[model samples]
Target: MPPYPYLATDYDGAAAHAAIFMVQWKREGDSLARYLVRIGEMTESLKIIQQALEGVPGGPYEYFEMRRFEGLKDPEWNGFEYRFISKKPSPTFELSKEELYMRVEAPKGELVIFL
Candidate 1:
């Protein structure tokens, strides 16, 4: 809220404190998933940001675990990308709660735990 974004660390004091933007974005491709986080720049014509993550899909499952966060600037673009690898890849099955957690009666008249 101080007109900038700050990254906190577990060591003790804040780690990265710099002019940052509120809007961040995420992107994923065949071999790379990345995030663009604005760190500094005056306008869209002079954009500067950090590539918060750029790696294969099976890389670290946490943001902080990403190793190479590089700085990039583009005078004609505005974007941000980041990924919090979820506990599971987006469930392609897209099953509803009722489908995932259900109780069933067995053929022999027994209750089955189908959660």
Candidate 2:
């Protein structure tokens, strides 16, 4: 996978979010196999979320499909407030896998539990 470019936001301003951590982890592993494995795990978690949302009591499940290619390719920086918090590159940026996993999974698991 190529380095994905995006302005990552922190939810709690505690650490750089998952994507940033993935990019760095991809670099740290520095191998195709490791990179694929890491991404596979992340993708699987996201898939679990998608599966859990299937055929729910809503018009449609929309979280995973919220962003389109055009939006990311040319994102509009209109100063609109984002749902997620922004984490600037800083000395205190935490890049631990445990934190990243918790950030991504805990919320989803909570939602799934509620469902």
User: Which is the leading candidate under lDDT?
Assistant: 2
lDDT of 2 at 10: 41
Give the per-residue lDDT digits (tens) of candidate 1, residues 5-114: 54434434232333244443345442323322332223421322332222112435655323323232432122231233122222123666665533344677635344
**Model 2 segments beyond 4 Å from truth?**
1-30, 59-115
Task: Show the lowest summed lDDT stretch of 10 residues, model 1.
Answer: 47-56
**lDDT of predicted model 2:** 0.41
For each candidate, what TM-score against the reference? 0.14, 0.23
Error of 2 at 33 (Å): 1.4
lDDT scores in order: 0.34, 0.41
Cα RMSD (angstroms) for every candidate in the order listed = 21.1, 19.0
